[model samples]
Target: MNPFELLGVGRDADEREIRRAYTAKLRHTRPDDDPEGFQRLHEAYQRLLQIRRHQANQQPPVTMAAPVAPPAEPRPASTPTSVIRAEPVFVPQRLDIDAFCSEAFGRAATGDNRMLSEWLQEQPAFWSFRAKADIGQQLVRRLYRDEPAMPTKCLHVLLNFFDLDHVHAGHDALALQRLSRRSQLAWELMPEHRQALAARMNMQRRPLERCLARLQRPYTWWRALAAGFTPNSAKVMPQFIRELAGPFIEDLPPSVSQEQIRFWTSVGHKNPVSGSQLLFMAGVLSMLSLVVMLGAAATTVFSSQTDMPRLALLGIGVAWACGLLWVALRYYFVLDEWLSRDEDEPARWPRLRLATVPLLLVIGLIPCLLLPLSRGMGFTFLLPALWLSLRRYWRRHDHEGFYVSPGIARIGLLIAIVALPISPSWVFAVATLLAWGDDLRRHRKVLQLAG
Candidate 1:
């Protein structure tokens, strides 16, 4: 339900009304008693507060001029009208490289390079080559090598002399290699410049071959991913993979499409529901069911004189399994619905691949593997699973908002671990209940600002 409808308040309701409504609702819907109800109420109250704050901050709209009045004077048809003409303004045409460079050289010749340096200082293009000594050196020697000290502008102007279209000779390649030697430009930018020059010269450019001169330079994977693997990027995957390898000789796999790469990258950021909250609730439910089943089994085992009904025990086991399956399926559908809300083709497989396989291995497979051996063995197995789960949760906290803190999850694990040796059935049950209780309260606070 919408926040306003859930709160039983109008859109214009004040903070006081919202708070009052929330308090009244909380009386009947405590987190421990009715988590879903309390969650809805808390979300409504928070949404209203945000709406109120937004309304208060908004500026009142200013009305513009009303309907314009008709002109008072009607011009006579007989009167001759005079038209005013605007004067033409002169604008200078752009100077070509040859003309600009010639003027700079003339100024330098007249004043021993001082005039040329001052003019070059005002040119923005000169500073772009500040770090390239080879490119700067060509301009330095040609322009002001005889001078005692060279100005920064002279170096800049010299860089502007090279025309990429004219870089056919071996000297051009040598100059570029020398310029790249101690250059401080970003790896991507240097390659980009080289590519542009190659394109202008009508030469085939191989970024992988040209860009990897040094093996010691650090490579940023994420930056490369962002640059080469974005959805709209025109980069070829095979070429990008080659570039990523730098100078390494390992055989690389063929690159996937940009859409596939984007889908995989986006999976990490998807959080339709708070993972910790879901985990807590599921853990609690599982623990309680296990405790009840274990208690019945324990009683049956202790009473050796009386024969237990095998059929009845089998039926109970089936019913418990069905219940767990139902819960799991329901949660899965809910998650699917939430994630499908915005995407056209949600590409569920990629997300499932990223989130489900590891989860199953840690939470389901490991525990199930130990279940056939002993109840104590199963409980012991859970310690490592829970620890791994906690580690996964901690790592994802930055990307996904946490409903329960990693510390709390760790504490819950500790409690279960301690309680297991004493009472295996009670360990999970108590921990699960506590986890849900903690999650419910935390979730309420989290939803307060949502609208």
Candidate 2:
């Protein structure tokens, strides 16, 4: 769009005239009602200003031959003899704040840091510490109101011009303290800003960053291993970054000095990547399963059966093991609607879905196929008793709305699946009685020791 036509102004109009045209359009085009129109007007306003600046720069300097000496009248010489003195007029320094924002934060670059610094110091409020606080507060409010306006340069300018990052306690002015207090706030900080802060401080990174890194580790680790290097490189980082960073940003628990947040927020975020531990663990386990398959294949060599059957079983074993790994991977990233709820009330699977039935069937089938009938039956029934002994190991974990691990969850699933093909009611009855018996025994032992 031609900005001149968009603003309904002639190309020769001054900055104030173009501003007036935009102001008129701004009133009629409410952002909520006509966002596109408002955006167009905003773009045109910025473009027109850039064009004006370019024109001013390119225009040749006007030079004229020296004016004739007759330009000075003889009366002026007579009047000068009276020793007329001209008083210095006080021209009030009015800060056109709207103009400042338009020039400073417009889409196009205004100038280098030096030019911006000069322009910023030109404001009257910059000289008065208290007024600097007042005017800066107004500019901040305006920026927040128009949040679509990114703070790439404006944030930097504000920190430098107002000294928002630090305060000198010995200073006589109290306004600097106010600016420092405002600087410590997190309401104006965005996610990218906080992540960058965490990176530079050598602090724990965001948990989401960790999750992503864990997910991507396989390709990276595989590449490294193929190149004859260590697949596992350890870094001592917090298990969860958000836990520590939350307090820092909010100034809760007084986690860090105010200067840290200020300097970090001032840095422009260009680095963009993070960690993912869960998927990396899954890949490690998958490789372990492959190693076990290799061991099983070696043991099959003694069998009298033809090599064809042994090879078929080996292939089936590999596929089945891989299926388990696939299930783990699937549950990790792509969960069903039931498991997608918030942590306060986590999602759960339905009763009949048969959670750990695959693991149970796989374990039970090995004994039944290889052992004598009597021993196999006894061992199959003994499964519930062995499971009941894990009472002390039933640890509680954070159900972070996604798969962190599958240990205890698979156990609970195994028990639920027992209700189907196994001893429908006796397994639960036996497990409950065994757990109660262990507790009773412990209680009696403790009492005996005390006595």
lDDT of 1 by residue, 1-451 (tens): 7777887877667876776666546546766677677656765666566667767889443222254758858789998888542222212233354455456555533323455644554443432223222444444344332221222233333444432223542346544433332121122224334454344334456643332321223333433333322322223432333344333322111222333333223322224433322333344445555556676677688877344456446656765577567556655555444332322234455445333323433453344446555555545545433433444344434356655767777877888888778765455444444443453354454335331
Q: How far does residue 187 in candidate 1 sit from its true spot (Å)?
A: 24
lDDT of 1: 0.45
At residue 413, candidate 1 shows an lDDT of 84
Candidate 2 per-residue lDDT over residues 71-121, each given as its tens digit = 644565445455432222223356778887677654213324566665565
Task: Give RMSD (Å) of candidate 2 vs. truth.
Answer: 19.3
* The 10-residue segment with the lowest total lDDT in model 1: 247-256
Candidate 1 residue spans exceeding 4 A from truth: 1-381, 388-422, 432-436, 448-451
lDDT of 2: 0.46
Q: Which candidate is the best by TM-score?
A: 2
Top lDDT hit:
2
Please give the TM-score that candidate 2 achieves against the real structure: 0.31
Clashing residue pairs, backbone N/CA/C < 3 A, model 2: 209-275, 210-275, 210-276, 211-276, 213-275, 213-276, 214-275, 214-276, 214-277
